[model samples]
Target: MGRKVALGGILTAISIIFLYLAVYLPSAKLTMYFLTGIIPGFILVEMGARQAWLLYFATSMLSFLVLGNLVNAVPYIFIFGIYPLIKYYIEKTRNILIELTLKLLFFNIASLAVYFIWTRVFLINITIAFPIVWLVLGLQFAFLVYDYVFTRVIFYYWDKIRVYWRKDVR
Candidate 1:
């Protein structure tokens, strides 16, 4: 219990740091957010869904407070932060078609929510130089790639990093 709490706190702090980076490094905002998103998966794997969800809430609230901008926290809140849990449950079904369908559906819905919030609520005028459909398609493709990379990272951590930690402790 002590270790779980400590691990959760450490991951939460790391996530806040990533969120801070997103605020200062505009060019790497998405990358930083992506990296932050990866932490929840680690939490979920090491602890459990409950701890991971707690981490998500802690990180989300801290990010908004720390960044002082709701817009900056949008990606983490709307998409990346909660995605690992979503992925875990969806993939547990073990049906590729269902998993793919649900994952893509979640991505599309989350993307739309983010877009609507960014443009409508925030009143940020983003003039896309291309058709909106093209942008959506590109984002869909990018999401698939992101999902693949996310899974690979989880597997790598479980297979390699976690093993090393266990061995060192022994």
Candidate 2:
């Protein structure tokens, strides 16, 4: 329990740092935002869903307050931050097709929800800048890339990194 708390604290600190960097570095904002999910991914793999949730929410609230941007934190907190934990359960079915399908479904819905909230509620007219189809296609491709990268990272962490980390922690 102490180890879990310590690890969760580390993950939360890393996530918050990434989010703060996202706010300061406008050009690298997207990359920083995406990277914020990585530590939570590690927590999800090493600990469990409950601890991952704790770390995620801690980062979300800190990002919201420190960064002062609910928009920035929404997608991460609602979807990307917790994806690895969700994927752990999804992959238990032992069917690649089911796993991919569910992952895509979650990605698409979360993407659309963020888009809806931004465009409709906030009235951020993106139509004048980019067509809707183009945006959707971009998000589709982005999710594909994210899914691929996530799988590789998870594999590496579980098979290679976990062994070392577990020894030290134990």
Candidate 3:
């Protein structure tokens, strides 16, 4: 209990610091920086540990939009959805590193479609670099390294992640 709280506090502080620096860097918006600040702790909390929902809600309140703007739910979906889906797909199958790679490749295609639709529906200005930038951003946000890193990491814990889907356990 104490350790998780301490870790969460430390992570929150670190996130605030990172958010400050990123905000001042004159690239992404301050809200975007806040979103980055929030993600790591969000991941930690959602691991079925600690005050996950509390931390998530607090982070959302801090990062909330006051004036009307299109929500950047993309970041959240990338973290929770794509990352989990990729992991789940990889963990469920054996000797299928190549297959996992193909799935993620196709996942990127779907993500790009979502990006296009989101921009077309909400964002007034869609830059030419949006797709390219989002793709790179997706790779980072998805927490996926190259095919090599994935093969190595997944091989190590294939059984562990796979347990979540097992009827015997869940």
Candidate 4:
């Protein structure tokens, strides 16, 4: 539908802008990546899984081309960018324990992959002040918080913002 296509285009553009900002603002790179991740959820809710996937691929490719530095898009491409879609499917099982386990499993695996790619492939040196175990634990905790916040934002959009937009579109 025209509405879906328009919204998808808008969200994709917004995501690219965030990715662009992430390149310029080193301190806010993570935040920008997180925001870019959130945009796909809107497409998922408004359009569907297929549309969301399209948006993800479009944004990923555009970010890579526009940024011209794989390092800037690494976190988004590896983890944050695709997380919303992954989360949606994972949560559909409707079992809290299974969902939590699978989500954490995905996070850990993706994170390790990202670390491997970042350090080994990119040759970036990440100097951690503490032990690797502590870093892993901290990352797990942060992931839990991110998941909770992501759910809340989705619910809020569904309950409040989506209502207005749905009416307009109809």
Ranking by lDDT: 1, 4, 2, 3
TM-score, predicted candidate 1 vs. hidden true structure: 0.95
- lDDT of each structure? 0.93, 0.79, 0.48, 0.90
Worst 10 residues of 2 by lDDT: 121-130
Best by lDDT: 1
Worst 10 residues of 1 by lDDT: 161-170
Model 4, span 62-159: residue lDDT tens: 98788867787878877898999999999899999999999999999999888899899999998998898999999999999999998998999988
Model 2 stretches with alpha carbons more than 4 Å out: 128-131, 168-170
Give the candidate number with the greatest TM-score. Answer: 1
TM-score for each predicted model, relative to the true structure? 0.95, 0.86, 0.42, 0.95
**Residue lDDT tens for model 2, 27-101:** 998788678877777887788788878887788778778776667777677677777767778889999899878
lDDT of 1 by residue, 45-140 (tens): 887999999999999999878886779899899899999999999999999999999999999999889989999999999799989999989998
Clashes of each: 0, 0, 0, 0
